[model samples]
Structures are given as structure tokens and as C-alpha cells.
Target: MIERKKYMSLLEKWRDKKVIKVVTGVRRCGKSSLLRMFREKLSDNGVEERQILEFNFEDLSNEPFLDYHVLYSHIRKNLCGDRMNYIFFDEIQMVENFQKVVDSLFLLDNVDLYVTGSNAYLLSGEIATLLTGRYVEIKLFPFSFAEYIEALPDGTPHDTAYRHFSEKGGFPYTVQIANDDEMLREYLTGLYNTIVLKDVVARRKITDVMMLESIVRFLADNIGNLSVIKRISDAMTSQGRKVSVHTVENYISALSDSYIFYPVYRYDAKGKQLLKTGQKYYLVDTGLRNIINGTKGGDLGHILENIVFLELARRGGEIYVGKVDNAEIDFIVIKGEAREYYQISLSVRDENTMQRELAPLQAIQDYYPKYLLTLDNDPVVLHNGIKQMYVIDWLLQN
Candidate 1:
């Protein structure tokens, strides 16, 4: 396994802090692997094996301990009273009344807690209210392009790795199985079904599974386009689907909670008005998108945009789709006092396409860093002070 230095750095900083360390993301995105990596870190640092308590709720051996009370008793019985104890819970949300068990654990003086969950509902109103101000959330994503490169053989060129990254996506397991596309496709399909059935449909108690799948397919089909609940509802109705706007909205929310799709809101930087409607949805991973909708050439721009958006999000940027006047800038990412505007495209070979990609950033008055990222190796940087970068170069950079 390639050591995830970015996430491991976060774990090192938060090690042994009183705050509850919560790791969350879509399933098969390496949450379980991260926990195991951190556990190894603890042992390497001389933490006694007996002093550490670990439970994976997904494991069949722990089925009888599904009750919160039983889980609590098991932990209490294993505690070393004379020393500080570390508790690691994998997929803790599967247990009944888990928030109560977490709250009880928080009251203990000798325990430091870390928990992982695939669904956002795990930390929804109930857990948020119960453990308010006492926990720190650390989000995990699939392999970034940089990590993907690290996992490749020494002779592999950067461009080849990028093609695999775009085609196979950054899922750790998928990257490990690079030689077999069939196995990769099967794995992605199974993961997609598990998330849809277990995380969203079953958890949300939605009776219309077909409608939910239809909406997901529609969103997956159109990643970069502006979309709204009403538009989807009307289209489905026209197609004889007979779903309500409210139901569509509810289903979308459940999908977001499941971490399958992320909606990016529009921010009008020049006008300084936040638009409440018509946001773009980006899938959590491109591999899943390719699996659901066969890998096609027309949507490459949107897929690149989706990958860039997730990369920015993983780096702790507050990302928004920028709408300045009539033109649209691909992303507006802000961190601390620094901000960046980006325009993503597959290629800027045409004069009109080049002008169109550069126009939006030129319209913005701020002198903040502006960039045009594309797949073209010899992109010409225009006079508008925007930096033109190869997407692969940008992906490999810090």
C-alpha cells in the first residue's frame, strides 16, 4: 500500500487529542485502510497492543456485540486503568444507538476515540447534537493523481499514469488491479449497488428505487451542466415517471449524504450574490461514473472538472462554481485569505475555445491567482495574466 502521507499527516497532528477523530467518505474510498494505517502508526510509536481496543462493526465476529450496551461493556472490560487507552471503531454507525456509546466513551478519562463511517447521517443532527463541539472531522477521498503516480511502476510515464487515473479513477483497490479492467468494472459496479441499496435507499426508506436510480443516472449523465430539482421533476414527469419535485429533492439529499454525489453551489463573485438554485453535481469518483455511463468521449471535459473539484475539496478549499456575468468560471477555491479561479477544459486548440476559456477569468477584477488548465501540452498563455498549466503538472504539484 502506498502510504497516504496527506491523511497520515492529519492523523499525526490530531493524535491523542481529546477531540473525537471522525473519518468520513464514500464506501471503498479507503476509510478502513486509513484506520488500519493509523493503528500501525500507534504500534510503531510503542503503544501497547493490550492498551488499544479495536472493533470493526462490519465483521461477522462482532455481530453479537451490535447492541450499544454490549459494545460498551466490551470496551470497558478491556481498558487498562493505569494508562491511557486508544479506541478505534470501524464503521461504528452500523451498531444500534452508536451515538449513546460515543457519548459514554467521551466521558471516560483514559480513552482517546477514533471512529469511521461511510454515511453523513452517522453524524447528522442526533450525533451532532450529542457530541457538539467535541469532535473533529477528517474526510478521506480516493487516491489523488499524485498518489496514483506513486503507486505506478518506475518505468511508467506520467501521461500513461494520468490516462489510467482518469479511466480507472483513484480508488486504491482499483489502482492495484490495473491490469484487469473487467475486475475493476465489476468492483466498481458492486460498490455502486452497495452504496445505493444500503446507504441511500435502505437508510432513507425510499419506496421508489427505480426513480432514485433514474435520477442518479440523469445526474451522472450530466455532470457539469446546471441542474435543479424542478427541472428533473418536470423531465421525469414528461417521461411518465410521475415523481414529485419534493421527492426528487429528498432523493438528491440522500445521495449527497451517501457521498455518491456532491453538489457545487454557484457563487457570483462580481455581484457578490449567492444563488440558491441551479447547482452542478459532481460524482465522488470518475470510475463509478464511467461504470454507470459507459466511458464516452463527449463528456471528458466534465470528468476532468469533476476530478479537479474533488482534488480542491480534498485540499481543504471551499469550492464553488463561479458565475460572473454571463460567463462561467469552472471553479472558485478559497483557503484562508488566498483565493484561486480556475478554468478547466479538455483542450484549447481552437481560437474561439481559447478565448472563451480565458474570458471569464479576465472579467474578474481581483488580482488573485488565475489559471487555465487543459490537456494540451503546448498551450499558449494569453496576455490576461492567467497562468496556463498542463493538468498533469498541476495534479502532481502541491
Candidate 2:
């Protein structure tokens, strides 16, 4: 297994601090596996098995502990006096009033707590309010391009590995079946359905399942394009399926909360403000997008853009679809005082196409770094002071 060094380093930095470590991500993104791996790390570092207590609320046998009192009592009994204790709760959202248990345990001086949840709701509850400034969040994503490459067969060429990664996406389960296209499609489809039905519809008490599916289709069909609720509603209406704008808004929020789709707002780079209208939505994984909507075959342009967007996000960039005057930059990444602008395309082979991609970055007056990423094997060179990079090369560099 490839070690998730990025997340592990974050956990190590905050190890044994006076804060709860909350790990959250979409379902099947390996939250449970990460907690297990960390637990093993603890054991290897001389932490006794008895000092570390782990609970997976998803197991039916753990149902009795879903009550806060029961959970609190169980862990309190397990506490051997004196030494620090590590507590891990997987899918803690299954527990009723779970925040109470966490908040209560946190009062103890000898306890270090960790939890994994499937949605943002876990962090927005009364527990978050109580623990304000006392917790750190580690948002996890599916395998990245670098992680994906680690699983490739020995001696696979870079282009072949990239095509597989781009086509099958970076989900761990999909990687196991990377060579089998048919099975990967079926697996992703099942995973997507479970996320929608269990995570979104069931949790949100949504009654219009069909409408939700329609919206999912619409969003997947138009990834990385400017969108709004009214536009979504109108598109559904034109297709003979009527949906209200308010309903569309709620559905979109549900999708976002479930971590299946990510919404990127448009930023007015020239004005230095976020634009209120015309946002873009990208899926959590391109393979899932391909299974649901055949996005990979139809528009490699947007697929490349979506891949770049997720990579930027994985590197912890404050990302936005950038708008400068009449020109649009694919992404604007701001980290502290440093800003980087990116324009992504299939290739910058044509002079006109390169000029089009370069115009927006050139229009910006700031001296922040600018890049134009593409699939061409063009030598890395400066065109009008903007750096050009091969997208695959840039992804692996992270």
C-alpha cells in the first residue's frame, strides 16, 4: 500500500496536541484505512495495544455503543490510569449525539481523540461550537496522480500510466482493478449509487430521489462550466423534467455536503472579489464522472481542466475560476502572499491557442507566478513571461 505521506505528516505535526483530529471525506475514500494505518503506526512507536482504543460505529455489533452514555462509559472503563490514551472513532456519525461523547471525553487530561466522518455536518454541529479552536480538520481526497502512479505495474511507460490514471481516476478500489475496465465501471457505479442514496438522500431526508439523480446528471454533464440554479432548472425544464430553482439549490447543497461534487466560485481577479453568479462544479473523481456521464470520451478539454482543478485543491490551494476583464483563467491559486494563475488545455500546439490561453495571465498586472499547462511535450519555456508546463509533469511534481 502507498503511504499517504501528505496526510500522515499533517497528523504527525499535531500528534498528541490538545486538540481533536477529525478526518473527513467522501465514502470509500479510505478514511477507515487511514485510521487503521495510524493505529499501526502508534503500535510501532511503542504504544501498547491496550492504550489505544478503536471503535467502528458502522459495525452492527457496535450498535449498543451508539448511545453517548454507553460510549462514554465503555471508553472510561478502558482507561488504564496514568499513561495517555488514544481514541479512534470511525464513521462516528452513526452514533446518536456523538458530539456529546467527543466533547465529554475531550475534558479528560489523558486522552487524545481522533474521528472520521463522511460529511461536513460532523464539523458544523454543537460539538464544533463547543470545541471551537480546539480541533483540527484533515480533509482527505481519493488517491492523487502521484499516489496512483505508485500502483502501476513495473516499467509501465509514463504516457500509458497517465492515460490509465486519467481514465480510471484515483480511487483506491479502482486502482486494484486498473487493468480491467469493465469491472472498474461497475464498481464505480455501485459506489456512486451508495453515496447518493445513503449519504445524500437518506441523511438529508430528501424525498425527490429522481430529481436528485437528474441534477447529478446535469452537473456531471457540465463539469467545469459556469452554472447557476436557474440555469440548472431551465435545462431540466427544457428536457421535459421540471424542477424549481429553490429545489435545485437544495439538491446542489446536498451534493456538496455529501462530498460527491465540489463547487468552484468565479472570482473577479481584476476587481479582487468573488463573483456571486456563474459557479462551476467538479466531481470528486473523474472515473465516477465517466461511469455516470461518459465525460472522459466526450470532452477531454474539460476533463483535463477538472483533473488540474483537483490537483490544485490537493496541494491546499485556495482555488477559484478566475475572471479578469473579458478573459477567463482556468484557476487562480492563492497561498498566503503568493498567487499562481493557471490556464489548462489539451495542447498549446497552435500559436492562436497558446495566445488565447496566455492572454488572461498576461492581462493581470501582478507579478505573481503564471503557468499555462497542456498535454504537449513542448519544452518548458517562457512565453511572454508565463511558464508553460506539461500537466502530467506538474501533477507528479507534487
Candidate 2 structure quality by residue, lDDT tens digits, 1-398:
77898988888888799999999999988888888888889889999988999899889998999888999999999996888899999989888888888888888999999999987788875767887988998989999888888877778877788777777888888888877888988899899999999889998899989989989988988988898889999999999989899999989998998889999999999899999899999988888878887743768888888888888888986899999998899999989878899999898888899889888999999988999999897679897779998888898995
Which of the numbered candidates is closest to the native, going by highest lDDT?
Answer: 1
Cα-based lDDT for every prediction: 0.89, 0.88
TM-score of 2: 0.97
Give the number of colliding residue pairs in candidate 2: 0
TM-score, each model? 0.97, 0.97
In order, how many clashes per candidate? 0, 0
Q: Model 2, poorest ten-residue lDDT window?
A: 289-298
lDDT of 1 by residue, 90-173 (tens): 898899899888889888889999999999988898679888888999999999999988989887898888878888888899
Q: What does the lDDT come to for candidate 1?
A: 0.89
